[model samples]
Target: MPKLARTIRFDESDAQVFSRPAEAGEWAIPGGFEFSNWTEGDLSGKARQAFANGWLSLESFGRATLVAVAQVEEAELEPLARRLADHFVQLYGAPDAEAALPIAREEIAYMVELCADHSPNVLLAVSRELTEAGVRESFRAITPAEAEIDLVAIHGSAD
Candidate 1:
């Protein structure tokens, strides 16, 4: 089994704050690549909210304010990697799927590492800031009591 991050939503705020809100329970990653070229001015409004603390969902290319650690079966890995590779080709303009596959797998592997130390249902949030080097990201875990996430029901799948 592999552990990975899944999008979680508590209210409509995520929908309102993000240009495109990630669907609850979809596989997600820190996804700093989305803001790699952004300048200070671009980091305002909803976009800034996203840059400040959003996990990028692979399914919709949308943002989520929080993510929960979840266990994924080994069988799911290949398809997830392929889907991310396709995203690289379509969204990030990778030359081709063949060229993107390795990077996709690496990203997914990193997500697995991120979730490995946490138990299932452990909520995580990100904070980001752009520096001269590029986008820098930090993560913090929120307990269920602190987030009141037990009140929210997360559904769907990585699919």
Candidate 2:
């Protein structure tokens, strides 16, 4: 295969793309395809750049879909990231990254919404000491344990 501009990819194992944009927003699914809330300046150029690089389109639910893989070649990933970042600044404007200590933190929330079904649960926590010390290892790490919640729903029951 020829060298691609960006290593755009998606997993077949993952759930199908949700049908509605609002559904994706509610779930906080990362817009791995493009920037958000684009402004009038340079955003079109940025989107164009990404398309030139290697933005792949998948047909699902009569709409185009986008996704990316991290394992892409550096030549592709770098340009793709740069263009997409520019596009983000256009849409979302400036970052108001919550900051503390030595770190100027930026956060992105990703939520995958499963239609009429439940996805797996996730536990999130951060150590104060680690955060204060500017350590990132703990930020992205996950530790899951036996847990309980009230999300269960009863079906085909009469009360």
Candidate 3:
């Protein structure tokens, strides 16, 4: 597996209002891939609007970058991430990670939408790589508990 850094930026205003300060070693799942080495800040603002609804105003509130493992070569991750990010912007607008305190499970559905709308081709490519690595069957056989552990390890949360 190759360790890939996926970079995602949100308007600093959105970051301030919506996102938590990423812990030093936190993982960010901006789209489908997991990113570590997260760097977040209240940087600056630029106008960003949803392609679909256009109701949400988005801007560059903060920026984050994290490392993740990918089955593909490291070189491929960036382009793949770019495609996914574009897809996310098109499908559900940019991420607004803000949620009320005591965050409810259902409140973060936007994140799920982001992940799901990320490039299907990238997902298929990753799947092919996993199958080639001989872990596809094992992944398929994972118990719910094991799956939870895996998700937490990669995403830093089970929620």
Candidate number of the best TM-score? 1
Candidate 1 clashing pairs? none
TM-score rank order: 1, 2, 3
lDDT of 1 by residue, 1-159 (tens): 779989987777799999999999998988887899999999889999999999999888899999999999988888888998999999899999989999999988888888888889999999999999989999898767666544465554699
lDDT of 1 at 59: 87
Report RMSD (Å) for each prediction in the order shown: 5.2, 15.6, 18.0
TM-score of each: 0.89, 0.23, 0.21
Model 1 lDDT-worst window of ten: 147-156
Deviation in angstroms for 113 in model 1? Answer: 0.5
- Where in model 1 is the C-alpha error above 4 Å? 145-159
Relative to the true structure, how large is the alpha-carbon lDDT of every model? 0.89, 0.25, 0.27
TM-score winner between candidates 1 and 3: 1
Query: Is 2 or 3 the stronger prediction by TM-score?
Result: 2
What is the Cα-based lDDT of residue 117 in candidate 1?
A: 89
Off by over 4 Å in 2: 1-29, 32-71, 95-159
Candidate 2 backbone clash number: 3
State the lDDT at 3 in candidate 2. 20
Residue 46 of model 1, lDDT score: 93
- Tens digits of per-residue lDDT, candidate 3, 58-126, equal 122122322122233545444444544543455445563232211222222333333343321121111
